[model samples]
Target: MTKSRPNILLIYTGGTIGMVKDFETGALKAFDFKNLLDRIPELKHLDCDIETFSFAEPIDSSNMNPKYWVEIAEIIESNYNLFDGFVVLHGSDTMSYTASALSFMLEHLAKPVVFTGSQLPIGDLRTDAKENLITSIHVASLQHFNEPVIKEVTLYFEYKLYRANRTTKINAEHFEAFASLNYPDLVTSGVHLKVNTDYLFKPNTKKRFKVNKNFDTNIALVKLYPGISEALLRAVFSTFGLKGVILESYGAGNCTTETWFLNILKEAILNGIQIINVTQCSGGSVLMGQYQSSELLLKLGIISGKDMTTEAAVCKLMYLLGQNVSSKVFKTIYETSLRGELT
Candidate 1:
């Protein structure tokens, strides 16, 4: 008997990585998925077989939403049994958001779904697309004893692989476009792929893989700053059909100690609105009650999103709200790390 080569699927969702410039006209166009292997002959050198899938109409990551997320999940679900792993090519602008959303949308994921993109077009002479795309596929195809080594959603950028939900896009021009401040890189691509096995998420093998397409987008994000007005806060909290809000506060989740501000938050929570407290800083966990300002928020039932990126918090709230989780235990569940989005 002979061992079968792993089949890795390249899902192109559209981004800088897929664009190619015509030498004659200089006009950029989407790269056809059928010619993927032709364009990148280096792929033939990999031990695994490769396949490609593209959206009927390519979408920029800026236009990405819940509908597209469900589409991606459906693609994975439809081909779940056939492919060994998946690599999603997305735009760097909102890669973190899409990656985070996918983390929640795909439940009990036991295969790698590595999201990656480059800062330049694939046809550019100085492009980073080839390296990012090639390495992502390799990472996806990694296995030990015929079992996938990474069994979770991940984001690979520059030379680091991070847990999808833990990542945030910190730069626009630099090839190092993402940062996983709260968590360590799962793998580092240098002279060799060094995988931090202990940091990788291990899913329960017994649980069946599930695709969660239900995501409530009726939520808002509010970033607190000095002298934020009570009227502005009132309008946001009172928005019609708003089920949740991601409150990005100062370090350690501290916020205004004003009576008016506290009153508005209390009223909103009392009205059954879910409020999640996330830190505004790029790194650090939210420790409610550590300070007087944040203590009231904890007492008022605001969920502490400890060490979670705003991207993760937003998607988690959407996923939880879509499940129709009862208000009674929403805070408890939100605070707990459901998909390893938080510490």
Candidate 2:
């Protein structure tokens, strides 16, 4: 039997949630997390022992990258047995990417790992930080039959809990900073915290928590647009040494049937680079070959990212590439939903 007091590790990566107001000038700035408990007095009341570790110099969410993903994974890996759960405070900008990457990096996780951040500074009067921070910890510490309840990566925002990889930041200015258009909420908070058990992911208890820290971020996103020129297309496809491409195409994943564009994509795929076709519009799946333009992509062996958000597609590609998996096996893994990251 486990102790009633759950042990949670709070990883504070730079973001709005950790910011506070400068007492005299009233300027909102990142707070020193050394005094985190003093800042949030309510944490003491929870039935959990919380320990925090902040970055030496906090970085804005925009600067988040694959390196940081590996760092976070290492922290969890080193302290896996000590903590019952982990809650990460991150910026909303790249929170989905980090969450998604973590989902793949931390394999066979049998405890909750919830990522959350707020739109406003924590020290402000009407900041959304209070609720987001508190609720994330609550969700992290949740248990059933004396074991952790949620055993996967998750994002909690605006009173809703969603699978980490399935989420996308939809609103920048609003309190509801994210939405999982490809998937349903894992839990919703109202009169009582409701857990959608049917939609939740159950880990393979048979496998060990294998961490893949080597993620390759050598990827690009190409959104198809009308009147896209040959020079522009050629430059994008040839400019850098790209390992993968997330092609955000028109409805149903259609693109121009131009010979030049077709050849560029075919050459890339033949060179063993992955090209994932995802829909540009919300609430739809990418159906390759459903139209003439997209047929070119299908013929060239491009992979259909059916119902995957651009965020998920990009992060998943990076995660897969990090494993140094062969092109054939990479396709098999990308199209397969390993952690409920895709439909």
Query: Which numbered prediction scores highest in lDDT against the true structure?
Result: 1
lDDT of 1 at 79: 96
Evaluate model 1: give its lDDT: 0.93
- Stretches of model 2 off by over 4 angstroms after superposition: none
lDDT of 2 by residue, 1-343 (tens): 5566898999998998888889899787878777877989898888888899898888899999888998999999999999999999999999999999899889999999999999999988999999889889988998888888899999999999999988888898999889988788998977678999999889997888888888787888999889888888777778577889899999999998888888899888887789899999976898888888788888888888988888888888988888888986777778888888777
Residues 224-282, model 1: lDDT tens digits: 99989999999999999999999999999999889999999999988889999999999
lDDT scores of the candidates, listed in order: 0.93, 0.88
Candidate 1, poorest ten consecutive residues by summed lDDT: 330-339
In candidate 2, which residue pairs clash? none
Segments in model 1 whose C-alpha atoms lie over 4 Å from true places: none
